[model samples]
Target: MNFPLILFILLVITGSIWLLDIIFWKKKREPNENEPWWIEYPKSFFPIILIVFSLRSFVIEPFKIPSGSMIPTLLVGDFILVNKYVYGIRLPVINKKIYDMDKPKRGDVLVFRFPEDSSIDYIKRIVGLPGDVITYHDKQLIINGEVIRMEYEGDYKYIESGLGYIYSDRYSEYLNDESHSIIINQDIRGVQFSNVRQFQFRDNCKYRRTGFTCEVPAGNYFTLGDNRDSSSDSRYWGFVPEENIVGKAFMIWWNFGDLGRIGLSIK
Candidate 1:
């Protein structure tokens, strides 16, 4: 559902009703007469709705994690808060940027509208920036001819919704200045070229049996899920256009299954 659009609609309806009554309907009523329930309800709600709409549109917004793609960094039930203005202040619903701000950096966790389907939102870590050449082979990431550092952590185990328990190798990946953990299942190979669609800038990427290499197009970013082998990310689709960006996810405010995760800052 397009939540911001719905909230904007409600805000307009309530504000219009409240304004119309003040200009035309107020004096028509008898002096000292009580307001009708219909008028009273909308008038009372307009200010509150306006405040909520403003905050959600230009300041911050909340989103829930629906998949295990982010794994150790974010869980299935994690409710995260995204900083809306950190990247730029875009108009709500239309999402057209009216201000300029910092561009997304490598290793930053970003939430963006899926390039293939704008209505669907996806979250992934930025692995490649504009003009950077990214290569992934043998479960290692290389950017601009430099191999990103990776150190083996240990064996990691987790439970899948219906697959019971699964084990994988965990490693700490140092991408530029950001250090984060990732998991890889050696039994599964990387995405196959045949399974990928002819997305925009498809020619810029070359896929092989082991891995793939791509040069990020201008104003676009390459991303990947923390759960390496389990994620369906840029390797399978395409780059994330700058306009499709929503915001940088910064914190986990709630997690029904794990209260300990509340208030934890996102890496």
Candidate 2:
């Protein structure tokens, strides 16, 4: 559901009624009789809705991780806080940026509207920036003809609810001077290209059995999940436009599944 849109509507309705009461009905009501239900409820909720709306729209917003695509960095059920104004001030609901701010750096975890479906929000790490040439082949990342450095971190064990356990090779990848861990299943063959979606700048990408190469367009970014082999990211869809960005996720405020993850900083 579109929670922000719904909140905005509520804010407007409640705020309007509150204002009308102040201007037309505040002193007219008799002390013995109760105020009209509509005025009473709206007046009671207006301040609260205003405060929540302001905070969520301009300061920070909370989100829950629904998948393990981020694995070690962000687990399923992790509740994260995204810094809204760090990217720029944007209008609520429509999410149009009205101020300039820092651009996303490589290795930053970001939440953005899915290009194919704006209603769906997706989170991933920034891997390639505008004008960058990115390639992934045989589980290795190549940017602008230079292979990114990776340090083997041994094997990562993943526990699935239905499946017993899964093991994948874990490596600490260095990109743009930042380091982050990623898991890749060597047993999985090259990325599948059959279900590739046609996206903006689709012609800039070349897919093959080994992997894919993409030349990120201006004002667009290439993203990938830390769970390399299992993620449906830029390799399958396409580059993310700057305008679709929601915010940079910075902290894990809560994780019902893993209490230790609470208060952890997101890289």
Candidate 3:
């Protein structure tokens, strides 16, 4: 469902000009009077274009956090802004890179096309870099032969607009050397990690619960979810090709019922 911003802008421009021609310009009523300089123009296209440019280039773009796969960190209905330029500027839609930027780092929240289905966009945290072995066993993340450290922080209250509440474990884990808290539903464990026969880019992945060792393939990355046990990530689907990346998600700009959702970083 991702559309190129260029198409959106073109649509807006065409519609605006055509509408103005019908309402005010057609009759030529004002002529020089116009509707008072600024008022006479659409005045709408500017904001739209700004949003498209910022979202398509140097800043963040809005996205609806879809599934509970990212439960504790992101929730359904949470509309977040993904950092576009952090990983470079690729024109929207076709996703052709015209500008080069930094690559994704560990502990970063990312948005990318599902390796299994490029048409579907999925978000997860980067767990393994190219050539790093990643293993997850007994719910612990093992990367490059080292287990990621996690500290228990009791429980967190789950909040969804109208849904009352539920308590979940609050644990802080360090990845890419960055520390962050995540919520987990213990009742959801016991599911085994499955491996892919072969992936589009990389060939195969090893499976374990204490974590597995996966040398991230060239131009491919290993990703997981902050809500560990819940994500359908590289652990299940396979590695993410560099070309599949949409962008890096950094902020939550707005939430319908709660403005407090704004200004939080994704990691």
Cα lDDT listed for each candidate = 0.92, 0.90, 0.73
Candidate that beats the other on TM-score, 1 or 2, i.e. the better one: 1
lDDT of 1: 0.92
Clashing pairs in 2: none
Per-candidate TM equals 0.97, 0.96, 0.76
The sequence of per-residue lDDT tens digits that candidate 3 reaches over residues 24-70 is 76587655555544443445455566566555555666789877678
Total backbone collisions, model 3: 15
Angstrom error of the Cα, residue 256, model 3: value is 2.0
Lowest lDDT block of 10, candidate 2? 157-166
Candidate achieving the largest lDDT? 1
Name model 2 segments beyond 4 Å from true.
31-33
* Winner on lDDT (2 vs 3): 2
